[model samples]
Every structure is written in structure tokens, then in C-alpha cells.
Target: MSKLAWLNGLPLEEAKAEFLRCCGSTRWAEAMARARPFKTDTAVYSEAGWLWSQTSTEDWREAMAHHPRIGDVSKLRERFKASGAWSEQEQKGVQGAGEDVLQGLADGNREYEERFGFIFLICATGKSAQEILEQLRERIKNPPALELRIAAGEQAQITRIRLEKLLTSP
Candidate 1:
């Protein structure tokens, strides 16, 4: 059966678990499960976007907690074991990076978190390590208010991609 059909048919508790795996927000997952029986893949994505927009700063932070630090290969393998496959796929760009670039990313991640009180977030799906590093360098200059919004936007993009993945998976 198709994934969309599978999602449409799952029980509420099971569906909430699946959505949590995709987005990592209990509220978002519960809201999605309550909005069930989605008629199409687009409908699922639409609802995801809407629900995310309705979420709070704390909710965004909760979702962000689900991701491992970028360039942190050990955490990607161990800390994020629940989302390890997806995280690895999303960060394919970092896999073959040079050590200097990796170290730069690690250092930048530290500085970003220290400055903003949260991890640096980027979509990172198709970006190269150098490209991601450049983005990090630039975004780190932004003030906290602006950077939090930027991070939330990136998380929204990630949620949309994961939602698409969920519906397309077998």
C-alpha cells in the first residue's frame, strides 16, 4: 500500500508516533493525528506547515532538540539514533568534508549556541559543507531576535521535507 494510504489508515496513537518521528514535537504530532485522514500528500504538508506556524518558541526549541549538532558525527551516530538515518541523509554534504572545515563547523556551532542559546540550524539538505560553513559565518552575525526567526524558518523547511519523506516512504 502507498504511504499516504498507510498514514490515512493508522490508528491515532500509532499515527502520533509516526508524526513525532517526522517532526519531534508532541503537540504538532498530536495535532496532526487529530487532523487525520488526510486526503492527499499535499494536504499532509499543508497541515504540517499550518501547525508549525501556530507553534510557540518553546515548541520550535523542542523540535530543534531532535537534531544533532551539524558536523558532530559522533552524536549523529549515537545521540540521534532515533533519527539517525534521516539525519545522515540530510547531512550528506558534511560526510566527505575536510577536517579543517569540520573543525570550523564545530567551532562555529559552539559560538552560535553560546550567542543565541540554541544550536545553529540550517536546512543542509543539498548544501555542501563549505556552503553550510559560509552560511554559518554570515548568520552568526545576526542579532538574537532575527536569528531565532531564521532558525525557525529553517526548521519549517526541514519539517516539510520530512513530511514529504513520510508520505513517500514504503
Candidate 2:
């Protein structure tokens, strides 16, 4: 879909404010602000792409603090629901795969957390269990700097999806 129309009607200030709330780290906040006036949805996503590229490992870790471990995602969903940022539909979208996949995510999550002290962060919307698993497996051996970059990229994807939802709202 064209994000151009969505951009035109967006309350830029309000949208930025909400984006800031969802993602509060300084660089991410700045990137969202700077990404306004996107000519297309793809362009907006491009900003996310850039944000991940430019982010430092420290900043990525800071951003990850906003999310929970992958397997523990249910609690994150509950938190989002309670905060009114998530509806049933959105929650379901986040949980886009099977329990077995979640179980794998949990195992991966545990190993990752043990290795890194932070949750395994990925942008789960629209991804299948196998796809996510592949990523998780590949990411397991990433060096700290590389993993942070990859994780931040995934976070940026999630941020963009959530931001798009705001534009689609009444």
C-alpha cells in the first residue's frame, strides 16, 4: 500500500509523539522524527533501515530494554494490551506462529539471554515460524556488535509496523 496517503493525513506531531513513547532512545527518537514526510511506506521503512544501520551497540541494547525476551512475549503482549497499544488483532499478529515455534523461541531466548544478558529481539509481524527460527539460529552465533545491529534492525521493523497501524486508525 502507498504510505503517501497515510503520510498526508497523519498528525505528524502526534505520530512522532507516539513513536517516541514506543521507542524512547535518543537516536531512535531522532530517526523517527527525521523520517516524517515519507513519500511512500517503503520510504518510511527505509528510515528504519537507516536507523538500524547507524545505531551503536549500546543504543541497540538500550532499545532492546523496551522489549521482553522472545518466549516471554505473552507478557509483553499483556503489557501492550494494558497500555492500550495492542488490540486482540495486533496481539495475534505478534504471535504469528505456533506454540512449538514459541517453544523454540523460548529455548533460543534462554541461550541468547544467558550469553548476552538481554532478550532476543525480532520484529515478529508477518513472519512465519520457520523464518523466525532461521533467523534465531543464525543470530545465535553473532558477535556482540553484529547481533546488536541485527536486533536493532528487527526493532526498527516492529516500530514501523506499529507506526503504520497508527496511520490506519480512526
For each candidate, what TM-score against the reference? 0.95, 0.66
- Overlapping backbone residue pairs in candidate 2 total 0
How big is the RMSD of model 1?
Answer: 1.1
Candidate 1 residues 1-170, lDDT tens each?
A: 88988988999999998898778788998999999889889899999999989998888888888888888766686787667778888899998999999999999999999999889999999999999999999999999999989999999898888888887766
Please give, for residues 54-111, the per-residue lDDT of candidate 2 as tens digits: 7677777777776655545447556554323432333344365677787787788788
- Give the poorly placed runs of model 1, Cα more than 4 Å off: none
Residue 153 in model 2: lDDT = 70
Quality of model 1 by C-alpha lDDT: 0.89
User: How many residue pairs clash per model?
Assistant: 0, 0
Alpha-carbon deviation at 93 in model 1, angstroms: 0.4
lDDT to native, each model: 0.89, 0.65
Instruction: Judging by lDDT against the true structure, name the best candidate.
Output: 1
How high is the lDDT of residue 42 in model 2? 68
Error of 1 at 108 (Å): 0.3
